[model samples]
Target chain A: MRLPPILVYVLRRLAIGLVVLFGISAVAFSMAYLLPSDPVTSRYPDITNEQRAEMRRQMGLDQPLVVQYARYMESVFRGEFGRSFGTGNSVVQDLAQRIPATLELASFGIAFGVLVGIPLGLVAAVRRGKPTDHLVRVVNIAIQSVPAFWLGVVLIFLLYFQWRLVPSPIGRLSPMFISPPPVTGFLTIDALLAGKPDIAFAALRQLMLPALVLGLGVVSPLARITRSAMGESLGEDYVTFGRALGLRPRQVVLGDAFRGALVPIVTTLGFVVANVLAGAAIVETVFAWPGIGRYAVTAITTSDMAPVSTCILLIASSVAVTNLIVDLSYALIDPRIRHEYAR
Target chain B: MGEKLFEIQNLSIDTRRGGVTRRIVENMNLAVERGQIYGLVGESGSGKSISMMASVGLAAPGLLVRSGEVGFGGRRLPASDQKGLRGNLSHGVSLLFQNAKGALSPFLTTGRQVERVLAQRKVPKPARPKEITELFRLVGLNFADLGEKYPHQISGGQAQRVAMACAMASNPALLIADEPTTALDVTTERELLRFLTRICRERDMAIVLIAHNLSLVSEYCSGLSIMHAGQVVEEGALRSIFATPLHPYTKGLIAAVPDVDEPHELVPLEGSVWGGRNDIVRCRFSHRCPHVRARCEAGLPPAIARGGHQVHCVLYEGEAA
Candidate 1:
């Protein structure tokens, strides 16, 4: 039986994605191996040379590089990422616990970016030469220029200390409330599932500052892409033709031009999400949010190869998946692309 | 001539760049009677498109409509009030562009595009599909075959027809076709123009066929205004203007068309439309006119009328006197 062309296209993309994921894992493993500090020495600095050699042998690090890589890949295929010296827990367990926090933060950040950025961009494109366009451009540039961590610190100072508007920049939940049982792993969702609105709201409130800091970083690129794309779409002959047909200005701008602009905006959104996932390390550390980004950072500093490589593979896979979704979505938004793929 | 359907009087447009304002279109006037196919012939950058677009309140954002009045559907609206003109006049007018495919929304199927116009014209939802099919058939397209396809899925000729279907959906009284056939081959161009003329006669619709090719205008238009730079160098009924070519620029334009029966050396127009200075209030064609004289620089010459033909040139000034 023949598969449909779209299904074939998706399968091909998935196969390529798998190969890329494998390549990324290999690279991450090699790069970790090349690190100057040995994981054994870094963890137990006072150990004798013989003890170090024995530990390396036990960990399979004494084997040839290819053999070690083969063994690592085998364990990875079995869903085993070994143990993280930094946390004294299995790498998979550590990631499972912390991935939720990162995902929660990143999702909120992306939501903030899309909600605020797309409208601002459309406004800028519509009022291209006016003061509003200029103001949006200026504000986007300002937000993009400030470092995410520094912005997080400043926001914490203002909203937490000076104004007392939000709770302390501690972890995901206040000390008064224990975290809900992990259902989907998102604290807010898990809390709500566990029938605790107050805990869910507290989780959300704790999410705001870090998410905003990460989101502010995301806004500029999304808005700038949206502005240019929408601007180009607005200038298309269809817009003038639509106006000439007596379509309402709102219909012409939002219905026609915005839809035309969505392809690029969505493509940019994928890139933004991938970037946020990877770049959330600084903000996560600042906010004391237990996400994979902070975990990766901690692993890197302590020369814990297992968690570091796992985090790299996780981030790389997310980016690959995002790109795949973006490519697939192009077919959904544009019939031209769909036709091309169908053929 | 039949009753006037649309008119543009004293329409001028300016563009400001780097703190300098330059007039791109000057004191243009046009009148199209019902069921007439009028031609606005000019080279690129001669403001043929700008003037018509400005009259309909569709001019580019940077272009300033300095002064004008557009008399359309029996209402004389100030050309500067673009918002008012657009809102009031759009239902009575529709535009067809050179690149029909580009002028179509790529995301919408061809039928949906036409249906959108029908909806905007307040055709009830249940009736839109039939109306769309009727329009598609009217434009020489099969709705079932082509309606479901997007712009890129069809050929150039089909896209143009789809655009035509969209234009006809509003039942516009005046169709401003801005180089509608520029992107098509010769056979398709003739077919489209013939279809346009047939539609005009059948519906009593007026069409302003804007083109750079004088031959195309000569073949189809009843009356025409010849634009050079920003000004109309000549305006007259087509037969009379072609018979007794008065303006030097118009004569040159006619001479430049290669006749297949009697081959002659093509006398191509000498300077481009952009060679003139915007600061001088003289005949804009003076820089390119073969018959340019010192008197040509005095200012824009007054229109010297003969029968229904008008020529703005110093050569005609003496003859009129």
Candidate 2:
């Protein structure tokens, strides 16, 4: 009884996510192995066929595709991402070290997106027929259209080159600071917890440029969606009923109208997560923000098999996690969906 | 049924254009006594909903009252001051919309939706388990048998009954049931109407029953009005209006109702209720009137009264007669 409909829904989605992860792992493995370069020969030039064969036996590259896939899957199932062919370091360890910067940037980007976008949407909705809405419309369209890289370049040019207002772009911390203790593996929060407030601020400052570029794009569409949905919701009979119930303007907007408008708005955020994850590769390269994307880039350049496949599996899992979160949110946002999905 | 609830004096609604404002409902005067059901019957777009919604100061966003004075329970209501009438009055005066499915919040449980109106009154909250069970039972739901439920969990008739239960939550003095049975099936409609009429009698509450069916209005309402293009064309006691329809539109509407006493073919109305907003000076229904004449369009038609009944046709006037 404790495991009710929502729990069942979550379990079903997790199974589906696992299946998708397997598919991704297969594609990644095949692509990695199918590439022209061989790690044994490429890394060790003038290596004989006998030496390469021994290396192949140890790496299990001689095994059938299915057996190799099952073996890789078994290791990944046990939380072993295998060793990187390029660096000879465990892929899991590399990801653990790099993931903090990506999380900091991505989470901050989401925060700024919601903060800026929701207000613009409300403002546009309230001033619907006037020039204010029109201006907002134009701006929203413009913001979404502007590429993240271009925005990053423009902001970096204006902030760093012109005035030199921000900290150095070399790393997640300033020249003065040192690494904080790894707790949740997030540097900023870990810094704060370590009683290093200055280091936390420095980490935040480093993330600011990349966060702004990524966030501005996501925010524009959210604002547009909120405005349109609010306009529709405000006209519903129940909203009129809410008004008649003597609810104040603030109470009406927040309580009845906003919630009614939020269904579509929340759904849109799911797509945003997927887009941001994919777009992270570009943003990461631009800001030198180390994450899976930077790791994948290095793997691809040197044609590293095990690391690239493992990274692909991780990215696939993130996409699946994003979808699961979205599905869970639907039940919370509108119980009607939960009721239907329970069956 | 008790004492005076509201009085409408010279209520007029006009559709405003660039320079000229076209009159839709004109010189609509009526009164709703306390604990009484005042049925307002009309054809589609006859402005029954608009006139009543306006008379109670509840018009749609675009439609505005050009001139009117509404008195509720001895208190005068100015058109400009619409704020006071809501909630306190909304609690006192609940609106049962035409579409029950559309009225209740889809997200809320049927029981919570019912309890919501009660919550508005600043009353101490009732225990959820007891109140929801009782409310569901009152609305004729077998609360025990039904699996943990939401709005979509219930049937249509049950949903409407839930709507009624919600409306009754505030213990309202007046219920503006705007075609409350319009969306229900024949059997459900009859059952729901009977339930509503029963609630009105039991609670001693006033109801403004708006519908297109005159026979329905005649059955439930004590006193009633027939609307034509936003104007109150004819109004009096329900029995009197049925026995003797004074206005031409009222006569047409009565004639249009299929003879229930003896099964027969329906005599559809000769013409439609349209183009009234564009007319500068005329009885708007003149084009539709079988006995229409040049005199009907000469000016704004005068209302001729007899006892409690008022008819807005030129035939009763001295010169036209």
Candidate 3:
């Protein structure tokens, strides 16, 4: 039986992604293992040497490096990521509880970035050297230059403290409303599913500032990439031919130029999403959002090897998967790539 | 000859960069009679393409249409009024470009690209597929095999044919082909031009064939213009221009092309097309002309006309054809 070329390509990418994830896991394990502070010692500083030995043995940390790694891998395949010292709960459980919040925030951030960035880019490219183009470019630069945490704080101070225009930068929901049942882990979605509009609205309002901060960080790269790609596409012979053929200006620009510009824009968007998912730590901390970013930060500071390594693996996997998706999307957007893959 | 189908009169284009304005095309005039394959031949950057593009109101952003009037289908519109010209002449004018593959929307299938033009021409939705199939067949393409394929999936020759199909979708009265075969092979070039010539005659549509190769123009065009720097140095009936080449630049261009049966040393044109300064207002080809006289640099040489032929040269100022 022969596999289709697209299927083969996808399989190959998945295989590569798995190998990359494995490598990332090994690196994360090695770095954590080599840390100056011992996990057992740090967690139980006043324990006797004898007690520490027994604890290490119980945790399987007393084994050789290879044995410990093999055991950890075995447990990982069985969906066990050990326990978080700070929470005293299983790593998987902790992650399962917190992943939804991070995903919700990141989704909103990405949404904001794409919605604002792409149109701004299209306008700038169309208006090129005009005032609108200049304004968009300058604003993009300014947004990009500011740090995300600072932007988040500034927004909080202005929107929350100064004018009370938005909900306080407290958490994903107000004290008045309880979180809906965790059906799908996204508060907004779960609230909507439970037919609770007020809770969903509150969750969305709480998400605004942090998502905006995360989104502002994303906008510059997305807009700049989009602008340059769109500008180049607009200058292509097809655009001229389309216009000369008497196609409406809207049709020519959107249908011809925008389609040409999509490949790069999509690639950038994928990377931006992955970056936001992995590095929303500062934004999460500033907003007191209970997400993986804050979880990872705390885990890292506490030197809890299991949670820290898990977070690293999660970040690495997200990047690898995002890249794979982006690569696959190229074949959809461009016939050249599709033909190449078919061969 | 049929009636004049398209005419560009006194067309001048300027490019302003950092406060310095350079005249890229100056007082260009071209008239294409119905069913005529008119050649606008020049070296690269000699402003043939720019003049033709500006006439159709498709000039690039930096280019300014300083002065010109495009008369199409008996309706005259100023060249500077690009929106008006585009709106008015869109149905009557279509363009074919040098890079056919690049001129095609890569994302759209060949069939869809043609269909889009048909749709823009407001062909009813129900009749579009048949119209598209007919167009594909007209361009000698099999709709079943090549229609669904994107531009990159097809060969250069096939892509050019696809572009041709799209160009013909509008049933345009004039098709401006700007080096349409430059990117294709020699065989494809001849074949495409032959197809274009046949189409011109069959449909009674005028075509402005912009080319840099004099031999190609000589072979295909009924009438021709020889542009140097930014001005038309010589233009007339192709046979007459080839028979009695009056302008030195035209003679030089003809000499430059290699002939197989009549093998001769190719006399390469000495200087590039970039005329040093734009402010002088002299004959553009004065620096490159073999018989350059001091009077050549005095001012812009007037277009000396004799019979139907015209030449811009000091030597032709008093000569009778």
Model 3 error, position B55 (Å): 1.0
Per-prediction DockQ comes to: 0.70, 0.34, 0.74
TM-score of each: 0.95, 0.87, 0.95
Real A-B contacts recovered, model 3:
0.80
The residue ranges of model 2 lying beyond 4 angstroms of the native Cα positions read A1-8, A33-79, A247-253, B1-3, B9-27, B54-58, B74-91, B126-148, B259-266, B275-280, B319-321
Kindly list the per-residue Cα lDDT of model 1 for residues A164-222, writing each as its tens digit.
Answer: 99999887888989988888988899989999999999989999889888888778888
True contacts kept of 2: 0.25
Clashing pairs for predicted structure model 1, backbone only: none
Candidate 3 residue-wise lDDT at A116: 94
Q: Indicate the residue-level lDDT of A261 in model 3.
A: 95
Which tens-of-lDDT digit does each residue in B1-321 have in candidate 1? Answer: 689989999898999889888899988889999878999999998899999988888889999999999998898999998887786545778889999999998889998999888888888999988888899888899999998889998989889999998889889899999999999999999999999988888888899999999999989999999998898888979998988888888889988999888899998878788554578887877777778889888867767887578888888776743
* lDDT tens readout by residue for model 3, A105-209: 999999899999999999999999999999999999898889887878888999999999999878789888998998888899999999999899899999988
Better of 1 and 3 by DockQ: 3
Model 2 agreement with the true structure over B90-131: per-residue lDDT tens digits: 547777777777666666776666555556565567555566
Model 3 clash pairs?
none
